[model samples]
Target: MLSKHFRWNKSRVELLGMIILSLFKIQNVQIPKIAEGIISDAKQDSVIKRIYRFFKDQLIDAVEVAALVVDILSLDKYLLVIDRTNWEFGKQSIISSDFI
Candidate 1:
């Protein structure tokens, strides 16, 4: 029967949609532009290739938060940061460090 020859397929529009969705997952736009540039020239790369580029294009949180939470999650000792003045500042780094 003709039904035996039927095959499902995703159109180019669908492929582009999926790829675009991957771009939105990054909280910013710059990385998406870079990812788009990397794969722009490909005429017919595999879906796996697109996914590889997509994941490879991720932005990681470089500031390692020395948290009581994450350490406890890992079952490590909870760090205690005590101040003599009982004053607390954010344990986060400034954006200038990200420039390099």
Candidate 2:
């Protein structure tokens, strides 16, 4: 389904799936924790690096992602709620959002 809209190569799509699964398994968005949850033959550090590169490269388009969600849910009409928050997680400044 993702391949139809995104230009990502097969491996990238697979990596995205892995990341999503890991997020569900661990219920955390932090890179290190996500990396820890990932099941891969690659080294943990390598997986972490790959995840960082995935975001750093900006491979995802938000508009396309929204469209994909709509299609998946087969929604004709729906309410969208988005909440944005800015805070500090340890020494790092974090901006987080929830969309429903």
Backbone clashes, each candidate? 0, 0
The whole-model lDDT of each prediction reads 0.43, 0.85
TM-score of 1: 0.21
Which RMSD does model 2 reach against the true structure?
Answer: 5.0
Per-residue error (Å), model 2, residue 27: 0.3
Which pairs of residues collide in candidate 2?
none
TM-score of structure candidate 2: 0.74
- How many clashes show up in model 1? 0
State every prediction's TM-score relative to the real structure: 0.21, 0.74
What is the lDDT, from 0 to 100, of the residue 79 in candidate 1?
60
